[model samples]
Target: MATIGIVDTTFARFDMGSVALDEINKNASARTVRITVPGIKDLPVASKKLLEEQGCDIVIALGMPGSAEKDKMCANQASQGLIQAQLMTNKHIIEVFVHEDEAANEKELAQLMENRAREHAVNVVKLLYKPKKLIKEAGTGQRQGFEDVGPLGM
Candidate 1:
């Protein structure tokens, strides 16, 4: 079983992410994947706690183009911070980029996001690549201790 955490910048994005994740979880192979969507934030503290408290096996930071453009680096930065935090606590992390504007329809977008998440899960489980740690300890400025447990393979 995999406990998954999802964070997005807006309600629409969150809804989309939730729907997509839900679909993924419905699959027989993903039946054990529990997902939570804790909408976006400027800081990672709250979001981090939610995931940690849930004992998430993997955290997926979902971002859309519009939201990503707002801070220019919001998606990238948040993903990095959350990944670092989750890793420090020994959880896996995956950054999922959903191209909403480019999507032909809502269904398509949701499907795309679902596919992306599935792919990410697969990579993490396969130990193919480790996501970079993006946050630094408050005072130490040192790499926190966390294993890059690969994504949950589909």
Candidate 2:
């Protein structure tokens, strides 16, 4: 059985860690362990390293950066760190983040975060258990949270 690790940031209200675990359990037969950090900037590197050391086959990282440019900068830094962690461990880390301003309101933002987390959890399940299906589901030009956004009025 595969073991999945979940790392979530607490700066946002959404409980991405719980949602991810639920989604993973529903779609796959893997076990999950979760850890929640204080903020988005704290998520990527240490979480991945700790989970890898714990023998996790896959890691799911969740964070919510604020609307400020500083938050964006921090998120970018976190991403770079995650990339390095992936290289060092040769393990997959699924980064799932929903910005505070991704939506027009708090409710919309929560929905977006939930969607992103659940979708990525499906990705996590597919990565280890069903690689072929994942390949077929690829090739989309949509942004991170755009896949399930439905029709947008431009």
Candidate 3:
């Protein structure tokens, strides 16, 4: 069975990692390894370790950015690092980040986190076991947290 890695942040208000794990279990038979770090900046290293040292085929990096300027900058830096890590390892790291400001209230934030994590979990499964599924989705303007914008007829 393929091994999947999940790297999440303790700073997040919600438990996106658990939501992803549950979704992955429901969809595929892959083994999962999860690593929890202190913040978004820590995700790159943990994800790299999971792929390079833990025999993971693919990784899911989940983070939550707060509604602040510094938080947004930090999230951007983390994203660049994740991209670099993917390039270094020649593997895919499916990034799932939900900004706290995206939602109006706690309930909305919770739902956003769950939706994004659950959607990306399925993406991880597709990358491992059903790549063609993604091909069919290309340019479909699919959004994770809210409704998909749908493909603008090209």
Candidate 4:
């Protein structure tokens, strides 16, 4: 069985992580290990490192950065660290992030985060157990973004 890791932060909505776990379990028979940190500042080195050291194959990292510039800086730093961790471990570290101000309202932001988490959870299962599904879904709106612009035109 494949072992998946979840590295999350308290700054994000807890339900988002819970939903991700449910999605993962519903899709595939796998073991999931979760590590929750105080905030995104600790997600990269602390939680992810611990999970990787404990033998998780791929890690799904979730964090919610604030709209402020400083928060974005910190998020970027953590992301860079995660990149290094991925290189060192030779495992995929899926980054799932939602900013507070991305949506006009709180409810919309929550929904967006939940949607992103669940979608990524499915992706985790597909990547680990059934890559063909992932291939079929590719270029088919699996990304967690505002909208699909399709191909650019002159």
The residue-by-residue lDDT of candidate 4 on 53-141, one tens digit each, is 77788888899999999999988998898888888777788888888878898888888888889888888787888889877766665
Judged by whole-model lDDT over C-alpha atoms, candidate 4 comes out at 0.80
- Stretches off by above 4 angstroms in model 3 are none
Q: Please list all clashing residue pairs in model 4, or write none if there are none.
A: none
Cα-based lDDT at residue 84, candidate 2: 79
Model 4 regions lying over 4 Å from their true place: 145-154
Candidate 1 per-residue lDDT over residues 1-154, each given as its tens digit:
5555555555445354554466445542432233344443432554466466766555555555543466446556666776677677776555656655646777776666656655554444433223332222223332111223544456
- lDDT on C-alpha atoms for all candidate structures: 0.51, 0.83, 0.96, 0.80
Q: Using alpha carbons, what is the TM-score of model 3?
A: 0.98
Judge candidate 3 at residue 137 and give its lDDT. Answer: 94
Candidate 2 off by > 4 Å: 140-144, 147-154
Q: Root-mean-square deviation of each candidate, in angstroms? A: 10.7, 3.3, 0.8, 2.2
The sequence of per-residue lDDT tens digits that candidate 3 reaches over residues 83-117 is 99999999999999999899999999999999999
- Candidate 4 — number of clashing residue pairs? 0
Ranking by lDDT: 3, 2, 4, 1
Could you tell me the lDDT of residue 124 within candidate 1? Answer: 41
lDDT of model 4 at position 152: 39
